[model samples]
Target: MDSKNYIDSGILELYVYGALSEKESMEVSQALQQHPEIRAEVEAIERSLTQLSTAAAPYQPDQVYQQIKTKLNFKDQEVAMIPITRKRTNWPAYIGWAASVALLIGLFIQFDKNKELRQEVVQSQIEKNLLEGKIQVAEEDLTKTKTILSVLRNKDVIEVPLQAQQVAPEAYAAVYWDKESQTAYIDVAGLPTPPPGKVYQVWSLKLDPLTPTSLGTLDSFNEEATKVFALNNANESEAFGITLEPEGGSESPTMEQLYTLGVVNS
Candidate 1:
C-alpha cells in the first residue's frame, strides 16, 4: 500500500501503543526504515501521546487540531486533517485480565471435583471392612455348629434321658456320657432359663444308701447359646440328678429343689 493509505489504516497507532504482534511490529519497523513519510508519522503520533499525558486539562479536539496545524505550519485550506476520535481502548490489558480470571475459575472447579472423589474412595473402603467383619463372624458360627453335630452322632457315647421331677414338671434334660473320656455332656435345651443369682448343679448319686456327691454348678447357663454343658464326672455314679442352687452351689444336695433324675443303664 502507498504511504497515504498505510497511514490511514490505523496500524501506526497500534504499533505505537505496543498492541501489534511481534511479526507485525517487525514489518512496521521495516516499512518505517524504507519510507521517510512513515517514520515521520510514527514520530508525530509519539509526540502527540506524550503531550496528552502531560496536559493539565481534559482534551479538547478543536483546540488540539489548531495547535497541531499551526506547529506543522500548514497553509490555510492546503492540508486536510482527519478528525481524531477521543475515545481509545487498551485491548491487550483487558484481554490479559480476562485470561487470569478464566484460569482461577478452572482451578477452583478441578479442586472441588478432586475432593468429592477422595471422599467417595474413603467411604467405599469403610463399607468393605464392615462386610468382611460380618463374613468372618458367620464362618466361626458355622464351625461351632458342625462340632455339635459330630458329638451327637457318636455311637460310643451313652445317652440317658432325665425325667422331670415334682419341683419342675415341665423341665427335662439328657446326658451323653463318654465313659472312656469320663466327660458328661448335659443337654438342658428343654429347661427354662434360670433366675438371676441361681444356677443348676449336677450330682453323682449312689442309690443304695442315697449318697450324693456334688459336681460343679452350671455357671454360664444363660450365656450358652446351645443350652448344653460339659462336665467332668470321674466318680462311680449309679444315678444322675440336677437341682436348682445358689450361684456358687451348696456343699450338699438341695432335695427340695430337685428338677430332674435318671438312672444309668448297666
Candidate 2:
C-alpha cells in the first residue's frame, strides 16, 4: 500500500499495540523501512500509546516508602518530612542503545572503506588499459622497423651512396633501389636537417644529356622518426641526386642547392 493509504488505514496503531499477527507486523516493518512518512506516522502512534500507558499506570512507588516509615513508628516525623524518590538509572537500556549506535558506526566506516577500494580498483583498470595500449603501439613500431630493415638489406637491392655536394658539404644520403618493384627507399639519416621554408627533393638522373626527373620531396624530414622515405621510381635511373628546394619542391633540380649526388654503377 502507498504511504498515505497505509497510514490512514490505522494498521500502524495496531502494529505498535502488538495486536497484529507476526506476518502483518513484519509487513508494516518493511513498509516503515521503505517509506519515511509511514515510519514517522508509526513513531507518532507509538509515542501516543506510550504516553497513555504511562499516564494510566501508577507512577508513585513512593507510597510504599511512606507506609514503611509509618509502620517503623516515625509518625511524629511524618508531618514535617518531605517526600523524596530517586529514579534508578536504567543500565540495560543505556547499554543496548549504545551497542546499537556502535554497530551503526562500524557499518558506516566499513562502507566508506569498500567505496574507496572500489575506486582504486577502477583506477587500476584504467592504468592497465593505458599501459596495454602503449605496449601495442610499441610492438607495431618494432614490426615496421624490422620489415624496413629487411627490405634495405636485401641482396638484390642496388645500394647507391650519395656524397656531400657544394651547397651542404656535411650532408650525405643513400638510396636502396628495388629494380623488380621499380621503387626506391632513400635513407636520409646522414643528411643534415633541412632549414625552415625548404625541404630535400630527390631526383632520378639519366646522366646522359643531363636529364633530371623529379622523384619526390621529403616533406616531413624533421618529423620522420626513421629519416627514411619511399618513392616510386619507374625510370631507368643512371644516377641519384638530392637538392634543397622550396617547401613544395621545384619543377626541376635546383642545381645551386644540390646537396648530394651519386652515379649508379651498371
Q: How well is each residue in 1-266 modelled by candidate 2, as lDDT tens digits? A: 67787787666755664545667778899998999999999889767645644445433334533544454446656534633223433333555567689989999999999999999999999999999999998897787688678887799999999999988888889999999999999999988888799999999998769999999999988877888888999999999999999999999988999999998988
Q: What is the C-alpha RMSD, rounded to one decimal, of candidate 2?
A: 17.0
Best by lDDT: 2
Minimum summed lDDT over a 10-residue window in model 1 is located at 82-91
lDDT of each: 0.80, 0.81
lDDT of 2 at 244: 90
Model 1, 1-266: lDDT tens digits are: 59998987677865776545677778999999999999999999988775665443353445554555575566567434432333434333454567678889999999999999999999999999999998997786677677667678988888888999998999999887888888888888888888998999998889999999986898988877777778898878888999999989999888999999999898
lDDT of 1 at 181: 86
- The local lDDT score (0 to 100) that residue 242 gets in candidate 1 is 93
